[model samples]
Target chain A: MLRIAASGDWTIAHLSAADGELRSLTAGPVKAGRAVIDFSGIARFDTSSAAVLERTARLLEEKGLRVEFEGVSEPQRRLLDKIDTYGTPDTSKAPPAPFYIELVERIGVTTREIGEEARGMLGFIGTVVSAIGRTAANPRRFRLVPFVHHMEKSGFDALPLVCLLTFLIGAVVAQQGAVQLRQFGAEVFTVNLIAIIFLREVGLLLTAIIVAGRSGSAFTAEIGSMKMREEIDAMRALGLDPMEMLVIPRVAALTVTLPLLTFIADLMGLLGGGVVVFFMLDMSPGVYMSRVQEAVDFWTIAVGLIKAPFMAAVIALVGCRAGLSVTGSAESVGAMTTRSVVRSIFLVIILDALFAMFFTAVGI
Target chain B: MAQKGEPIIEVEGLMTRFGDHVIHEDLDLTVNRGEVIGIVGGSGTGKSVLLRTILGLKKPDAGRIRVFGIDLAELPEEERRLHERRWGVLFQDGALFSALTIAENIQVPYREHLHLSQELMDELAAIKIAMVGLRPTAASLYPSELSGGMRKRAGLARALALDPEILFLDEPTAGLDPIGAAAFDDLINELKEALGLTVFLVTHDLDTLHATCDRIAVLAEKHVILVGTIDDMLRSDHPWIHEYFHGPRARAALAGK
Candidate 1:
């Protein structure tokens, strides 16, 4: 006798318990003349349950058994019929491309993005330069309040952190130079090492990198959110120039403050170098101060000082352009803000390098 | 097809409070098998709080919540999960995992509960995506790519993944346009009957209540003040209910019926 039996809820939760029983029925008793499938004990049924029942019926029929579904309710049959209509859905996902192809694709995409961004940045420069020219033509049109507000936030508020960071870095450079000079029996020359490095390069480079991280990301996030909320579009609709109202003030604030911040950073760095070498080496604080003072009088200090405003302009322009490029969504704001910090930092380092080569070539 | 229609869920003397603000007091509700119950309330009335409390997401301050003839609070963790597997809850928003595709989102519960092959799980997910009225191509799309209406449908598909006998919907029609809302109503009604489900729907959409609910529970003054049909709600003298049913938007909803 070919007897098939199913009992229990046969719902998704209870289907696991019924799995072994169903599997046994599907594999056992094939090539039967007649089979009786009983569903008398089922209390609950759903699409999954119906799927199991329909799977069993098909398996039996494929085995050439004349299947009889006993106690099959109308609702149960209807659900089974529903599943039967969409016999098997296509669930195939596209396979990922090969490694080299993917790598090439990534390189192409990155190159294209850099080119597009370069163009966009140039366009932003054109707009802001014209806006500044107009503001210069009529000084009354300049937004002094917003410019002061941004300067207070990005410059004055950044003092303590910049001082502490540059001071600590200068101390580290002095201590290490002293240790290395001690091996050469010329520990006194640690003053030359610390003075030349901090005044010529480390101080302003560190300040510019810090500004890129702090002020650049902040500006991008702020203006990106405004763009995301259509506030930029609203300002345009109201005939207020975003370049004047938003961009000019931000750029002006950073340009004015970054050079000042860089000067403060150089002072604190020299002070930090003096303190460290006075403790670690035979050089007196007076001698260390003399070397640092002489270095500042040369065009070396001027090179670092001049790089500050240019780096600030780079950070400000990148941040504002990235912010303006932001489409609607939190994701866009996040991506463009990150891009702002990265691009500005990269450009700052490259600009410092070019300035270094120029100073050498020009005998500064 | 045929159920005993026994009381599947019973809550009595329910109390809920957030800090000093009391949300529910001396509240009682019973959900019978295979019936759609709508919970309606004003803006601050805690209709969602009650639903979340019943789903065990929030702890009720004081109450007796017996589901499937067992005290939920007293049951062992494993034993309680067995009872929990009998129902599914859809949140107000889709709440689909942001990083996962629609297929992966639907497969999450199966991956947790079932020992099936990935191929079978994918097939089941595809079925669910189709059953909830989404195109087959939607399976590969992420939740971020979907519109608000499509996201709700995707959430419904995830809710239906386990084929539970009870479905808990939180504002299923909240953001849908009129035609979309009506089609959703029809879909819910059809699914409830076809799958022999007991639906507990919390909604602000007046049309959804008219079309899908067998009984409406009005929550006011920190309790379910009344539980009855739309006609009964219309006939009642409760101040809020009177204005709610006779209000301009309510009249438009009723006329659209």
Candidate 2:
């Protein structure tokens, strides 16, 4: 038998220094059929290093040597026995897949996920539409208090923020348009440019984006947390239709509020354009208002207003769908909230582009 | 073995209050090394508050707490951290980081405190997962994927990651079934014997106390009213103490023991 003296502090704090020596002992040429590890001089031991020692013995035994511990203290022996009886550690993690294979796998997964998401969203929209229709037919089924509360929260509270953002955007458009048009001595047309853009596109799209971020995110978070806490299930257990109780009020409020907010945004945007034209192009408010009045007909404003409720419906539907899909984790609530905002904004922009194309084709 | 009277934790005249509401006042308790001490109390008695106070998680209103013969409040920040590594705490919920896997959770303390290599840490994490009665496959799972009992076991494995000298458990067996709770009690007993760990357990599980505790400390009237073995508890004349030990649940626990 070959003897190995395993001594000193066999604890976590000292294990790093002893690691190489212990490994060399295990890997060195074995002159004898058996090896005895003497532990009489060990001043301290702990579970951390007991794991290391147990591993070292296993390695030695696997190398065709009979490994035995000798002269361990009572406590050390008990620890060793405990570690020995515990199952072995799994040291090998499977290797990752190759890059091209993983890339193909990811593309397939993403495509499937997008398809499922589209199907789920369409189903949710149908459910919300039916609920709205039911409440419309039977007016008493419409919850008055919650509808009023939601209008106040998702509509009235959003007024100042929406007005301020659209005003800034309108000012920027006036300033940039004046600078560009001045190159051709057409700076006087800045008012006409601002009027058409704000009424036809900017007012409606900007308000939709803001509300999607603000109220839409709130809707997803509220319902997602409710789902997480099992409150949604409780509502069903109490024979309440969550669609009517929660979804209809919030969606109807958004649909009503988005148009009103868009109208206010249109006014604030024109006021901002008037102010910028007065300072930058030396045009008075009267001249600016007259130019804006002659820029387009009722079609300019009607085009933007016509898209408001559709955008509202899409945003509300996306938010509620994300909320209802939340699983039993706090992390899922955050992830779904983000998804709601992003998807709503993306869908709103796509709908705006499609509306613009249709109106141009029909000579609006 | 540690000497009979070697105290690892000593709390004297510890007072804790939340604004005007006093949770504990003039409380005192001593926990000897290498023994399991169970703290029991009524609903509002603040058994967990005492544990938190000793662990320095909550500031005491007025008192001194000494752990390992040194007052933690008097130690400088760096030295306090060194002492802090000697003890570990398991909260009522697993409280595992939701983002990390079970193996990564167990390696958190090791990565923070030790200079071990990745392979060594992985091996250690696997051992801890198995030691806590978790299957090897659970190493890759997130805490949210685990059942309540499994989460508690994973929490225990994380607590033992650094080979702490003292383990503090707050209601370790609270949500587990009876069989799971009894197995947990046996695991604690076996771990204490093998590693010579000093345990500070705060729980209402009478069966756990009967199976694992070296002594029981009863908290009442904002102080430790009694501290002794179960027999000493059965002989006490204090009204709350009498009711607690002679209760039907206590009789069943004692009979089972």
Candidate 3:
């Protein structure tokens, strides 16, 4: 019979044949019945290994041999009891052990899944492009409800801030223009310069930037929340065209509202410039108004209004597009909303410059 | 009983691949009218993907899906929209609009698909809310104000707003207490009976399966291993089935019986 030797560390190492002399002295003989399994140094037992010990015990019992546990540990005894309660230890189909390799394989699989999901974004972009084309073709389907809501929320509601911003900008421009004109004893020319510049470029640009920051971000957050909650999915399931139901209304609303807001911003800016001329340049309201009338033509105001719809379209498109890009995660919604604001502002500025150049070339 | 007519939803050889990995392969399922079917699987088992594919949110690389006899792959965008108006879905977490009141949420389907007066829409919305067992006072509250179970009930109210014949629910009782979950199950059973709706329920809750499912399809080993009643599942010879049903929770539930 083979027996384990105690190593004094609560763990027994295998007994070698050279240790037979000590084994013989301890047990008086090396017969199977005289062999005592010392579990005194054994610790940290598991179910599978405990099963092997139980099997050995059963074999010894069947042979009419008494196996004694001289110093069996309490933990080892508890492990054995657990094994008994839990039934068989079928270690026949145990999995392979290289844990890091399995982890890497799982990470690779997840990475591939995410990569595929990102690639699917291109399909969504394509859908957006097709939606835009369809909207252009059948403008009638783009209903007035979203447009009305957006106008009230994004345009009409934004009037106070737009007016205040334009007024401040007009005052600053007039003051600066007055400083230079004063040097030449032509301070009244500041009125014409401020009015012309505002109607031509500053009014529309300022209004667009405000909308890009305000309404554009609002659209992103709203849509992003919907995407996260799967309301977008519910809409699709109900056979509702999400673009028609969600996007078109926003686009129409911004488009209708921007032009109206721009008109208001332009008027406020002119009034602000007139006030500066009246106070700083000491020009009368009549003289300043007459000069503005002479320098700032209908064409300048028309050019500014023309840019309004374009700016509105850009803001709405960027906002809605970023909103649609949300992927039903809280982080994704936040990230996409930020992207919407950045994209809207960037597009608005770039388009403003382009319109400036175009109108400049056309001698507007 | 399923009639001899076409199934409401038919998915054949549904294979969806994301980049180099395949989510599912050679999958086939048939959902008939007026049948309540439950789909059960571990997390990340493509159950949600399967539902999304049926709704045309995802286009499977190699498969055909037909909803209400209209082949999704073959239908044009207009036709797809027309088919979409016939079904309803209650997403996981209920997915109610946070900005809208419960009544307003229910009014969404009616406002989009039908040309009804504001008074009529309000009346219908109220009726739908009442049908879901929500109080009239709760109708004016926003989704953020509602509890998890209430949100789900409100979402069900919205889904029923269109009088849809088919309803898909994804994890309807996911975050509720057991008592609340059982109550939701009772609501589902009542609604199904009253509306004659064909329900496609996706969940991992064993209690939900034992209580409400007429038949359950278990996804395991990258395939559907079993589709049967609770008794059949308990008696199954499969190792996974034995392990699942003999677990502590199942044992406790059985012991109480």
Candidate 4:
């Protein structure tokens, strides 16, 4: 048995047997009357290569020589069918026609147009920002009625969940702090741990996250649906600034309501931690209350209060920005609502961390 | 018939692009006072974009959009808002606030722009709701409780709250049953005649187009290819134009004749 291993660059020229030497080499061993073609070494095969193989098979049959084919890859088999269909001398040259070039071009043009639109949107953002700035400058002109409605929705309606989550978080924190403080024979310090953290960070953080998930998502969905319905356009047609009439009121409401909610959450959380301190640490209610009062200073409360407006601003901005970014259909409203919640919570946490750093650096 | 005064809206070379997709390019159109022009087009052909650009909600990339003789692009944000009060737009969805009662929705624009007393605002809201044919009892109900037709009517009432000179309706009769749509068309016609409002209506419903519009502007092939009467459109030799106005679907729709 004659074994033949053939491997080379499977270019069109090589596959086509364009060179007399390569053709003779493929034909010579077969003509000598014993050969097994090993195709495993062949990395690439084209129509021309398949045609050469078919031609060699015919020549071997004519010479009364039995030839065995080996290592025929799937791609090679597919090429063989293509060669047979086209009656392959394989003169077709030039790269296989690009299927996606038109799609790519269309996508490119679309991307450029979208980029321009985004740039224009930047200008609109400036307008929105300035409008917000003006409203901030003239708080009286920004009516309180809409803001009052927003507060009822964002704050009052969200109270049950805020209270529940803060209570649970307070219990968890106090329990965890007691475990560590007891190791240091400072079990009484659990009151300070729970009180200080609850007043300074955890209470405000939990409240903001809840509001971001609840109110922020609500704002995005509401405005996003309005956008989808062209209600925003209708407002514009009626000579109303969507920012002033819609977003400003929402932002203002969140700004005012978040601080109040945070204060509420802080109070509730401290009460919850007092429960844990009283039971787990064997401290009396009066003693826990006195310890918390001594441990948490006004500055700690102020630091948390300061972070509330910032968190509120983040929630409002992310909600409105995501809502404003929505285009096309109802699906986009849902998508942006989710995006608004995620971005608001992320920004709130980041802002909280920064506030923590600032307070710590200033030794406040 | 156009009067000899300046057009109420003059949109010159208006071009709007969303990302790489060009929705409208070099679009020039005019809306005169007291003329109801219907904008008819296939889906995604930018009929809504033109109305939105005119309203200054979607800014045109390269165009001069002037409404009520003021260049919207040149006006400051506050001034643009002042200019906007001159027009009214009824969205297709009748986007009433779900939380507010019908009366409160009508009071929104008024309360935002005016300093009227609560009783006076309530009175004005009642009048507007009555104009839309809703009973006084309907005023206290939220939008979620109202029927589709009633919501559309309430939305119309809210649009008319400012007493705008120009009115725009986006698919006012869409999704409504035949009788409801006809009733809406009748309401639009009555409102148009009573107010002498310059109306720009965007619609796909052929019956609404034939019954209500003074003239129809067909958007095709990335342009407003034709703007004429139904008779003029029927006479045109353009293939798509013919297919649109006199096609099998259209013929079947009008087959009762």
Instruction: Tell me the tens digit of each residue's lDDT in model 1 across A1-364.
Output: 4777777777776675565577687888666688887878788777877766666777777899888888888888778777777666778989999999999999999999889878878888999999999999999989999999999989999999999999999899988888888898988777778777887899999999999899999899999999999999999999999999999999999999999999999989878888898787756777777776665566767878888999999999998988998986678899999989999999999999999898899887
Query: Which parts of model 2 have CA positions greater than 4 angstroms off?
Result: A27-29, B1-4
Report the candidate with higher lDDT, 1 versus 3: 1
TM-score of chain B of each: 0.97, 0.97, 0.93, 0.94
- The model with the greater TM-score, 1 or 2, is 2
Docking class of 2: medium
Which of candidates 2 and 3 is the stronger one according to lDDT?
2
**Ten consecutive residues with minimal summed lDDT in candidate 3 chain A?**
A9-18
The C-alpha RMSD in Å for every predicted model, in order, reads 3.5, 1.6, 24.2, 27.0
DockQ category of candidate 4: incorrect
Going through the candidates in order, their DockQ values are: 0.51, 0.71, 0.01, 0.01
lDDT of 2 by residue, B94-119 (tens): 88988999999998988888888887
Give the CA lDDT, 0 to 100, for residue A337 in model 4: 93
lDDT minimum window of 10 residues, candidate 4 chain B: B115-124
Q: Give the whole-model CA lDDT for all candidates, comma-separated.
A: 0.87, 0.90, 0.76, 0.79
Docking quality of model 1: it rates as medium
Please give, for residues B145-174, the per-residue lDDT of candidate 3 as tens digits: 788899999999887776676899999989
Model 1, residue pairs in steric clash: none
Highest-TM-score candidate: 2
Best by DockQ: 2
Q: What tens digits encode model 4's per-residue C-alpha lDDT throughout A14-116?
A: 3323334444755564445666767777865533345456555556655676767788866566545543443312222247547698789889999997697
User: Taking the tens digit of each residue's C-alpha lDDT, what string does model 2 give over A142-229?
Assistant: 9988888988998899999998999999999999999999999988888889999999999999999999999999999999999999
Docking class of 3: incorrect
